[model samples]
Target: MDDQQVGAAAPLAPTERTDYAAADSRRLKIILAGEAAMLVAAVLVVFVLKIVTGTGAIAIFAAIVTINALIMTWHVRVITNRGQHQARQAPGGK
Candidate 1:
């Protein structure tokens, strides 16, 4: 083929596309489920400890559970934000 025809017929470079909808949906569902499970377990444990011990023990257990919940929430938020930022910076993302 002529130089012009060869150049014109050259294949295009591969382009990247982010399907945010599917990925975001899946990630959100998983995060929600995990958070819910963690909260439920924490509540159950606190209740059990309260019943087995007393008011003072319940208070301590509740404080620990609250701290755990906060930590988990912060972790999830940080991870989610990082994923969103990366996706936005990716090629073809707006």
Candidate 2:
């Protein structure tokens, strides 16, 4: 065999563990779910406030919550992509 083949590293055992794509995927799912929950909470808050107090500013609050949700959704996607990219570029990322 050539030097390259002879010097190749052996594969890991069946019991070996590594943190990579699975962790990232889990984190992404959590982030997405959390954002969705927040959106639902915001909507609930708007309805509750409206029913309990009949406030005229309900629309404003709802608008704010929707804007917040949109912004946060964008932010989470950006962060998730950035983390994945950085992880890939990190030394021994796999």
Tens-digit per-residue lDDT, 1-94, candidate 2: 5433665554433233135455666777877787778777877887788888888656767687778778777867776786666555554545
lDDT of 1 by residue, 1-94 (tens): 5434543533322232245545665777787788778777877887887788766766766787787678768867876786666556554445
- Return the TM-score for candidate 1, rounded to 2 decimals: 0.55
- For residue 71, give model 1's deviation from the true position in Å: 3.2
Clash number for candidate 1:
0
For model 1, give the 10-residue run with minimal summed lDDT.
9-18
Q: Per-candidate TM vs. native?
A: 0.55, 0.53
Worst 10 residues of 2 by lDDT: 10-19
Compared with the true structure, all predictions reach lDDT values of 0.65, 0.67
Q: What is the lDDT of residue 19 in candidate 2?
A: 55
Segments of candidate 2 deviating more than 4 angstroms: 1-18, 87-94
Error of 1 at 14 (Å): 13
Deviating ranges (above 4 Å) for candidate 1 = 1-18, 90-94
